[model samples]
Structure formats: structure tokens, C-alpha cells
Target: AEAEAIVRYIKDNPSDNIGVITPFVKQKEYIKKELESNGINNVDCGTVHAFQGDEKDVILFSLALSEHTRPETYAWLKNNRELINVSTSRARQQLYLFTDSNALERLHDPSQEDDLYDLACYVRSAGTYQLTPKPVESRALGIRPYSTATEEAFLENLTHALDNAFSDGSHYTVHKEVPVSQVFMENISSKDYFYRGRFDFVVYRRYQKKEIPVLAVELDGMEHLSDHIVKARDEQKEAICREHGFELIRVDNTYARRYHYIKEILTQYFRS
Candidate 1:
């Protein structure tokens, strides 16, 4: 529906320079494909990051958020004010935001108090200047470790396998949740780097006191198959790792029993 509305808006005002921006790469691709299918390929359509320095007479922004989306999954959207600013300020004359109003409003319902609520309200105001709410003082209850049973098991097994495979002086260190940007220096924009994401585990070898990152690993679960966002993120991570000359080993949770298979791959990588 939002894609059709954007197409209609562009057609209705042919004189206005229009652009379509979406937060998700998948949605951006879908929107572009939809426009192209309808013989409307001239208009610019891309992710918000893709239009950072560009502006148009009119811009259509799609949130691509649904009611089923977990608020915590998109917490980054609220934390990064610059991202929101870029998405909303791309239109010189008019900006149309497509979202689920009910779902957005629910994010602010006293019990939730999510930053997306502020975002939803700001978008609802049609770019009207509004002071952002002051963050409430909060205290951390405790630092509880967060890891799925499968992930924990995989980490334990992989750690043991790596320890056994590598020599004592070689110093094969296994680090978890290593940021991708730290491993590679690229000419890509900051916005793209921001979402490059983290590797579940990174294997580094210290030879003659110089540490070298040799491999990255991702533990995939059922969610990766069912959730398009997770799948897209995984693909992006794999692409970036490959581009930087790092091999990414993706192991499914179902393969947890096949420790030898993972060990063999690691052995081959280390030996080569």
C-alpha cells in the first residue's frame, strides 16, 4: 500500500523532484522493484543512508515497521538521533511518512515508553519543530547475561575445539561479539558502517606478538530462516566479511551435534 501511494504521489506531482527513502535495505529493494515493475524507474528510491547528502522537492519515507516487530530490536533507531534527522529532513517541500499509527502510538503507552514513541509522534506532527522529551533517570537493576541455550552450547563447543586445534604458542584467541568495523577499514559511509553489525565469534592468531584476525563465525538459529531482517543482516555481514578478505563461517544451531564438521572447517582454515 505504501509503495502504491508513493508511486501515485510521484505521478500526481510530476514537476516535483521526489525521492523514496526506507530504513531497511530489503524494503528499499522491494520499493525500487515495485516502481520499476510499474514503469516508474526514473524516481530515486533508496535506503535512508543512501540519501544522506541529497534532497528532493518531495520525499516519501517509509518506516517499514509492523505491530509484530519487537521494540527492543529497533532500539537503535531511537538512540541514533542523526539517523532519524536524516530520514525526516530529506524533503524540501513536502514529506510523507508511511507507518502503522496504532502500532507506533502503542510504543509510548505509559508501560512501554519506547523512543520510537517519540519518533512516531514527531513523524505525526509533519515535521513541525517539537522539543524532544528529556530522558528519565533510570538505574540498572543488574547485569544478567543474555545468551540462548543453543548459542551458549555452540560457544562452549567451538571454544574447546579451537583450543585443541591451535598450538600453545600460536595463541589462537576466540573473541565473541566483535564489531565488524573494528576488523576492517573501508571507504564506505558512516551510516553503512553503523549497521555492519557484530560477528558472533572471531578467531585471531597472535604470531610474533602481532595479532591477525583470520576468521569470523555466525551462529544461525531458526529465526534467521523465518525473519527477513535477521536474514538480511546475516547476508550483509557475510558480504562485508568477504569484501575485507575474511572468511565467515555460518553454523546453524541444528548442526550443534556435528562438532567434528565445524572442527574440520576450522582446521582447514587454520592450516591454510
Candidate 2:
């Protein structure tokens, strides 16, 4: 009842940013809609995984102890201590713990303790904190949506350059509308993969009369400079790709935005 009330309050007040911490992932969509309807931008419901290396001025931790007392409770408690620690430490000042009486009673003090007691001791005391509603942190990504025509044109221009680059009688196969496979990484085991990273456009190259596998031509968008995490992850991906004898050509999006430069990178990569 309290959780629902808080969700309703945050939704009605859009000017106030809201953070919801729930033990279960089921509440995300419900909370997201409440915030969106009120025009309160930047609402995030964090699970244990999403809380890493992230912090805010205020934190609403929903520590439902019944959640922690399930079967395999000991393993969940041990492996998840860091997650709880990180989630609790996120608040610089205000901290609101939405929990039931049963959960509150589970905290074992020197004067009182329980099976899942030590976890509650880690929470920091914000000087005289209360249940006052606070604004949420704005960590929203500003992405401009492109129309279908724009995307089609972008891919058309991108492929043209790729075709021009690899004149080794190689065919360029574009997998534009397909989803990237996360399971593809499972095939690789051990050894440092180099030229690692994500590419905007992955062009597969097929060479005639040769047993060489397809090469991947990646298109790098201009936003690469602003999104450092993606860039770093891409670097790691590229390194991994190198282990499998795959060819990777990183064509800058700025270059792809233009036909001549895109063609130049493609021709240079494939022609080599």
C-alpha cells in the first residue's frame, strides 16, 4: 500500500524526479508509467545489477526482508552483499527505506539481531532524514529518433562505400534488419581478442574461390566521442574479434555521413 501510494504521488508530480528500488523486477513498468504520465522526466527503477558505479543525491531502498528469506537465502545474501552495499551508499543525503514491519524487525542490533541482520547495519544515516519526497536525479539519455527513410538512406550510403573499398572481387552482404547475436561470443574461448568493439554497421565480406570467412566492416557514428562506455566496450569487442581471424574496418560515421570518405575507407580496407 505504501509503495503504491508513493508511486502515485511521484506520478502526479512530474517536476519531482523519482528513484524506486525494488527487490523484484516486476515493478519497473508500473513505476515507469506513473512517472511518465506526470511529465517527471528521468525515472529509473534499479535492480542489483544496474546499481553498480552509479549514485544519486537521494535513494529509495525497498528492502523487503521476505525477499531475502527465500530458499537459497544464504547464497543470495553472500553474493549480493556488494549490490546491497552499493545501493545503500548511493544516497549522498536523503534515504528512504520502504519496508514492512516484519522486514524492520529482521535487523539484528547488538541489542537486536536476526538471520539476515548484518545487511541493514551498512546503511548510512543522513542527518535527521525523513519521508519527505525529493526530486530524482536526471540521468536520461537524449537520443534523436531518426525516420525510416533517414535510416534507409544512411545504410545505402554506408554500403556503397564498403562495396567500393574491397574490390578483391568480394561481395558485401548487409545484415541491416537483423538483431546482433550475443551468443556469438560463446564460440570463442581464451586468448586476448584485439580490435575489439561495437560497430554501427557490420558488413560481411565474401571472397570468391577462397576459404576465408566473412569480414566485418563497422560504421562508427559521430556520437562515439560522447558515449565513452560504448566506445570502451567496443574496443574490448574488437579485441575479441581479432582472435577468430575476422577482419574489422572501423569507418567513422562522419565519413559514412559523406559518400566520398566512406567509399575511401571501404576501398582502402577491401582493396588491401
Candidate 3:
């Protein structure tokens, strides 16, 4: 839908030196194919890296990843702020991003709190030319809501339990939905850990005045039991955490109801 709109706009405005920027090679090819099929052949489409050292009067960026996509699927783009900078800055006069608002909101990385989410908010507020369809509660521009009620309830409950368990002396702080990219791993390249995964919750113990990460937690849903990809990713995360000497605690959703068990697991690490 976004690509079609862009092509149509370019067709209407023949004089604008418009370019399409995508994060993945396959996406670039897909956009190029769409443009050619529509008989709009003048505009150039390429990945952000390919467009470096080049500038366009107007640049259309297609953020292809949706809320359902796993972080590892686009870890390279998510971790590399330089690539986003290159893509956003390549436009001399105008820049437009085609992204799902819900996906942008649901981005699960505190490290990107300023970079991605804040930038999106800034652009929405500051940009002069805006084109958004009418708001619909059931369907948000053809994108379904990202989080289900069950997930939201689980997260809330877990957060409340952690707060109650750790609120006594500030011995530990519980952070939710922390990106693995923010946590540095020893003897590993930045490229290796970039966007690899995210912890559902992280417990950081206070040492002197600084907070040090001590435990990473994951709340496994039923999907993790049956999904091979999810299992593989979880294994990879466990390996990385072990390599870095960070204890990872995996709890099934069924076990989440057992408050005593949860507290016991957390207390064991918080004291260590």
C-alpha cells in the first residue's frame, strides 16, 4: 500500500527527484518490481547502504518490518543507528517514512527509546506534509493490534510481583522488555549481538551507586513449546547469557501463577 502510494505520487509529480529506500535487499527488489509494473521507471529504489554518498530531493523510506516480526529478523537494521541516519538524511528537501504506528510503538528496546520511538514522535509532530487515513478502532490502517490481553495481563502481573518483592531496599530494579542489543557481551563483536533478541524482564542489582545486570528473565508462552524457531532462538539467547556470566531464568506462563515460585527464583539471583 505504501509503495503504491509513493509510486502514484511520483507519477503525479514528474519533476521531483524521488528515491525509495528499503532496509533489506529483497524489499528493494520488490519495490523496484512494483514501480516497473506500474510503468513508473524513473525513481530509484535501493537499500540504505546502497544509497550512501547519494542525495535525493525527496526520499521515501519503507520500514518493512511489522509488529509480528521477530527482532532477529531485522536485527542488523535495528542495531545500526548509522544506517537509519544515512537513510533519513539522504533527503535534501523532504523525507517520508512508511511505517506501522503500532509497530513503532511496540518496539521492544529501551536502547531505542530515544533513537526510534522518539524520532518517530518528533517526525509526526514536526513534519508539515502528513497523509494518514481516517482512524478506525478495529483496524489500524490494516494492521492488527500487536499485544493480546493475555500478554498484557501477564506482563502487568509480573511487574507488580517484582516491584513488591524488590521494593524493600532498592536492592534490585526490574526492567521490562529490555533489548539484548543494549547489553554488551565480552569477546564478541557488536554485529554479533546486535538485535539478536530481547529479554522479557531483566533484574539489575545495585553495586555501590551503579546498577549491574545480574539476571535475565523470559516468560515463555505456549508457542515456545511447539515452535522450533522460537526454541532455537531461546537456546541462542541462553548461550549468549551464559557466555557473559549472566543468569537467565525461563518461566512458563503456567508457572507464572505460582507467585511463590517466581519470588523464589528472583530472590535467589537478587541475593547472589
Candidate 4:
């Protein structure tokens, strides 16, 4: 749940200076690994003991100890004044606490003034949020300003192929790093989860003033994901394009670099 929250938060606020604080070094390392595996590597993650002087625009403080799992550690955490204080005080704009809410409720005694119990009360004052997990899209990973060299090569090969197939007239146009919403002609709202989605390439046919999309291309790499996760994410992207009345193609690295194969695909699609 903590990993999921961090991933979703980072996706929504891609540019924010984010940091993650956890009581245990193990949790800190695990969160860092998960983020990197998901192609998110910008946020800083550390233990609360070393986070005293640190402040970020947004901080995700994780109470790694839960009453059910580790009662002794949970008690240790609940009584530690300095740990709770440092964890709650290091965010400039937003501080999100990730914990077992049921545990918090069970541990908080209204009759007693405890350090961690008081911190739990404070978070409740700020309003507790339960984040439900959502589908993690591969196309939405690695938010960047520029396209990869592999993607650029695929576009160049596709462009040349288009020229050869439609020598008599312009039958197809190819674009790179196009936004998914723009391709689908959907109005973007801040609440839309896939608004950050971008097609690695899009194939279109121009009609004087308007360009009609027929194909959306995704250049697949290890950066997005691998194995079964890659298959699932690819299926999701394909379904999304199908819903928007276009074909979505995912090109693996070796195939993406081939000029003849790219030309052949353009010819087959636009020739008919």
C-alpha cells in the first residue's frame, strides 16, 4: 500500500520535490527499489533518524511498524517522541502519513497522552486518506521532455517508409511522443489518471486541414517494464487505443530499429 501510494502520488505530481521517511531502513530501501523498478527515480527516501534537517515540498512518512505485525516495535515507535516529531515536521507543503489505520485506532487511547498516539490524533485532524490501488500503466512511466534515441530511429524509418509507399501522394503521417488525450481528442481534466499518457508515436492520414489517426505506436524497452508486467501493460495500451478508434502497435527494441520492416508495416496499413 505504501509503495502504491508513493507511485500514484509521484505520477500525479511529477515535478514536485518529494521525499519519503520511514522508521525502518528496510522499508526505506524497499520503497526506493519499487519506485526505481517502476521507472520512477527522482524522489529521495530515507529513515526518520537521519531526516531531521531534511525538508521537501511533499513528504510521505511511513509508520513501518504495525500493531498486528510487530507489537514490540509498534510500542517502541508509539513512545518515541523524537521519531514522531521529526517524521511529522519535515514537509513544506504536504505531509502524508502511511500507516495501518486499524492499528492506529486500536493503539490510540483517548484517556492517555502518548507520543505516537498524539501524532495519530493530529493526522486524523488533517483527515485520513485511504488510497485504493489503481492500474499501473507502462505508457505513463518515465515522464520526460525528450524521446529516446530508439523511438526517434523508429520514427525516421517510418517516415522514410511512408514516403516510399505513398510516392504518388501523401497517404500517411507519423508523429512522435504524442499525448494520449490529444490523439483521442479527449478534453483533459486534472482528475483524469491517464492524462499524463503519451504515445511513443502516432500514425495519421491528413485530409486538407484535419489529420485522422489510424495507428498509435509504443516503442517498448526495459525502462517501462518486463515479463508478465510488460504484457499486461501492453494489453492495457492496446485496449485504450481500440476504444479511441485506432490501432496501437508495440514495437520491441530490435524490431523498432529495422527500416525495411517499418516500411513494410506502413505500406500494409496505408496501401489499403
Which has the greatest TM-score?
A: 1
Q: In order, what lDDT does every prediction score?
A: 0.65, 0.48, 0.64, 0.65
lDDT of 4 by residue, 64-169 (tens): 6455555566667765655654554456567787877887777665564355654555466673422112233312222221134445666788877877876677
Tens digits of per-residue lDDT, candidate 2, 86-139, equal 454444444466655564554333342221233333233322222112111111
Model 1 TM-score is 0.44
Residue 234 error, candidate 4, Å: 60
Of the two candidates 2 and 4, the one with more favorable TM-score, higher being better, is 4
Query: What clash pairs does model 1 have?
Result: none
How many backbone collisions does model 3 have?
0
Candidate 3 displacement at residue 59 in angstroms:
0.7
**Span of ten consecutive residues with least summed lDDT in model 2:** 136-145
Error of 2 at 115 (Å): 43
Write model 3 residue lDDT over 1-272, tens digit each, in one string. 66777777788888999989887787788889889998887898998667755667888888776767666654555535555565555665677777777775566475532334434544677643222322222212111111233234445665666677775666666777798866654535443544757787787778799877877778764335433455666777887776677788887644544567777776676677
List the pairs of residues colliding in candidate 3: none
Model 1, range 149-268, lDDT digits (tens) per residue? Answer: 445566777877887776655667778888887777673544474354788888887788777888888766433543345566677776677667779987764454457877887888
RMSD each, Å: 16.8, 14.0, 19.1, 16.0
